[model samples]
Target: MEKFVRVKGVAAPLPLANVDTDMIIPARYMKALTRTGLGRHLFQELRFDDADRERASFVLNRPACRDARILVADRNFGCGSSREHAVWALTDFGIRCVIAPSFGDIFSGNARKNGLLLIRLSETLCDHLRREIALAQHAAIEVDLAAQRIRLASGETIAFDVDTDDRHILMEGLDDITRTLRHADAIARFEAAIESLMTIP
Candidate 1:
């Protein structure tokens, strides 16, 4: 997983509230385990029409938002199922940070595990950011993880809170597997000790 230290990129406004995991990445797309290809199918239903065609009206479908790295959304985002694919899709689609008033509990955990920054702020703050993004598609937003500050393209800055351990993981690019592998030598030593103890004298 890529480390998220300080991200400065274009912000996309997803005004709708309560976007679920299924909506982010449909279950049909779960056939593939790799997170790479899911970016193409992110927001499958909303981004594309019933004919599987791109919906020009969709924020992601819009040219300005197609390459957005920071997603500014409304309240209760990422609700419903606890599929990790939802976070995968977002990160795969080049969205490193998501700012919303609230997020589904399970989805929040998934986001951190998948190296995505899920920012929870007040509803008023979210609305302010959403409006700011809508005003300018090319606006650049700066997400400083180290400082725990969100600086908008409009020159506004806001503070946010993140769990200390999660913040460390993001900063060090350490995932569960990566952390376990870091102690490979210790694990090997433990196995050797167990083998010696089991062998008859």
Candidate 2:
């Protein structure tokens, strides 16, 4: 997982609500356990038609949004399923942060673990950001995790809340395994102590 201290890049507006995990990356693409190469299939159904050809009308297919790194979405984003692939697909697609009014509980956890910042703001704020992105071509947005604020192109900054521990994890680029390894010495000591106790019994 890559550290996510701050991200400044183009933002793509996805105003639709109730976006589920499957929509982020369809289940058919879940055959691979590795996170790499999923970017090609991110939003596969929406980005491509039945013939698997790129749909020029899709927001991601649009020239301005093709390389967007920040996604501004409506409420209930990532609503269905608990697959971690959703976060993997987004990260692989170069999306570092997602701003939405709400998100699924499991998907939120998955995102944090994968070093993806999921920022929740008021519905009104989300709408404003989305509209701002739509009005401009390749509008740039800044997400500063340390400051917990989003700097918009209009010179307006919006504050957001994130758990302190999750913030630390992302800043330090520590995944669950890395986090556990930080306490390896203590874990080893405890295991040794347990072995000694077992021998006495």
Candidate 3:
């Protein structure tokens, strides 16, 4: 997992609501059995045509939105099935942060574990930021995890909310395995104590 203390880069606008996990990385692409290569299939249905051509009209396909590291999306952005691959695809595609009004509970947990920062703000604010990024030539924004605010190219800042534990996990780049390993000494001691008690009995 990558530490996400701060990210400053191009911001892409996804205006559609209820952008589900399947939409993020369709089920057809899940056969790879590895987290790698999923980015190419992200939004496969919407990003490609019948002949497997890139759709020019999609927001992510636009020239300015290419290589965007921050995504400002509409409400209920990560809704639907609980595929952790969605977060993997986003991170593999270089998306360090996502801003939306809400997210699916499972998706939120997956994202936090994978080191992708998800910011929750009001729908109105998300829409405003999405529109601004869409219209701007640079479409660049800054997300500071320590400050819990997003800074637009125009110098305007908007506050967002994230769970304190999630924020700590992301900032410290603590994946599930790493988090567990941090308590290795304590776990070893507990196991030894249990073994001694069993032997005495």
Clashes of 3: 0
- Per-residue alpha-carbon lDDT of model 1 for 1-201, expressed as tens digits? 899999998888888898998999999999895878889999999989889999899888887778889998888889998799998988888999999999999999888888999888888988888887777656788999999998887788999999999999998998889999999999999999999999968
- Lowest lDDT block of 10, candidate 1: 130-139
Query: How many times do residue backbones clash in model 2?
Result: 0
Give residue 117's lDDT in candidate 1 (0 to 100).
Answer: 91
Candidate number with the higher lDDT (1 or 3) = 1
Q: Rank candidates, lDDT, best first.
A: 2, 1, 3
Task: Provide C-alpha RMSD values for all models, in order.
Answer: 1.5, 1.1, 1.1
What is candidate 3's CA lDDT for residue 85? 95
* lDDT agreement with native, every candidate: 0.89, 0.92, 0.88
- For candidate 3, lDDT tens digit of each residue in 120-151? 88888988887777667756789999999889
Candidate 1: which stretches are off by over 4 Å?
Answer: none
Question: What is the lDDT, from 0 to 100, of the residue 96 in candidate 3?
Answer: 91
> Pick by lDDT: which candidate is best?
2
